[model samples]
Target: MGTLRDAMGYPVLRAGIILLVLALLISIAGLYRVDKSYSSSGTLGEGMHYLGDDKFENEYLYHNRTLTLSSTNATISLLQGSEMYNYTLVNDSVTLHPEMRPAIYVFNGEVNYTYDARAIDYPYAVYSIGAFVIMLAGIALSFIGYTQFLKDVKGGKK
Candidate 1:
């Protein structure tokens, strides 16, 4: 009969050890804990102007990830087909990105005011969930391997 040392050579145990190590390394990534991030949508004053399509030294305003025309009146002229948003809460304000990318917006209110914009969505908790799955799989493998190791030891004893 082989000694308990021989049972340590079990292939399942080796794989389980590797997985356990990998799970530990992956757990480090979980420490980052990336939460969902987004700027709350807001409204500005009405009577937003149709600033020039090429420049915004005057009426164009962007705040809290929101782009709007700042005016005290609720009137906007859409010369063509375009999207427009207004915020009656604040005036012209500037800030840095909550994320990145400074987009060039062309609010063509000169010939005809046309505003175009889009909404973006980002995944939340995906990385944390992925790491957790790997850890769970590794734990399951380790448990199975430990049971196999016990069986191997008993068989060796016989």
Candidate 2:
């Protein structure tokens, strides 16, 4: 630990660098999100049924001929955590917009009975927070070893 070169090779410094790399990997994993797709038959909005929860970013609607979201002019209470998105319907296929926008869809009581949707379920990542903590710890530890080496090189051991 007599020079910066020696400090870079110090065991603590090496461990800190390893932790930094691990943190980077964890952060990357955090960005990787998996979308869930599913189809449901029967009543989409009748009696009581939920679409998705806050745990989901947003649910994209894909309507087939066997599906109509709600009865014609049915009241959709936005206060219930359910929102609308802009979408385009071609033939029997529905494509949701990538960005969220206030677009009301009225099915006019079409005789479609099945609803399929793709939802991005992850709104938060525990791995990202963990990676941030690891990064901070690694920087702190690396600097600790760096200063120790610098002090030894200056012959100011106290």
Candidate 3:
């Protein structure tokens, strides 16, 4: 074990370590290349609606007012009928001031319409975690194998 070659004398241990390192690197890159797109949940109204903060802006019109809103306080206000509804900002939730649920049922024939924002791809995270665990296992196995190899060499065994 005095030289690099001597340290890697055990072929099985060396190959396992090398494969583990490659898998670790590939897993990291896969995580980075994973899909980052996510949706925000929100309600749809009759006219223009905005669902974002000062840094970003996502606008929608009457036809596309149904939006997946993020968990951020967006200055939501109807551009056409400002007085028709009252808006309240709450933590991760929004409230209609005048309680338009009844009116919505009468006009649109629906109590409310909301967009569900859920992650479509989650296997990337699972694979990344699995790779990390396997890498650790590989390192532990290599250590044990090297220790046993050294002991055998000292006892005059190959």
C-alpha RMSD for every candidate = 10.9, 7.3, 11.8
Q: Which residue pairs in candidate 1 have backbone atoms (N, alpha carbon, C) closer than 3 angstroms, thus clashing?
A: 43-87, 44-87, 44-88, 45-87, 45-88, 46-73, 47-73, 47-74, 109-113
Q: After superposition, how far is residue 38 of candidate 2 from its true place, in Å?
A: 2.0
What are the per-residue Cα lDDT tens digits for candidate 3 across 21-114? 9768869765543222223443544444433232212211112123322223333443333344333333354432221111221121111324
> Model 2, range 29-95, lDDT digits (tens) per residue?
7776666765545433323344323333234333221123333334332121265443223344333
Candidate 2: Cα lDDT at 1: 25
Residue 3 error, candidate 3, Å: 1.5
Which lDDT values do the candidates have, in the order given? 0.42, 0.52, 0.45
Off by over 4 Å in 2: 1-5, 42-110, 122-124, 156-158
Best-fitting candidate, measured by lDDT? 2
TM-score of each: 0.36, 0.54, 0.41
What TM-score, to 2 decimals, does candidate 2 have?
A: 0.54
**lDDT tens digits, residues 104-136, model 1?**
232322112123322322233346566677667
Model 3 TM-score on a 0 to 1 scale: 0.41
Candidates sorted by TM-score, descending order? 2, 3, 1
Clashes of each: 9, 5, 5
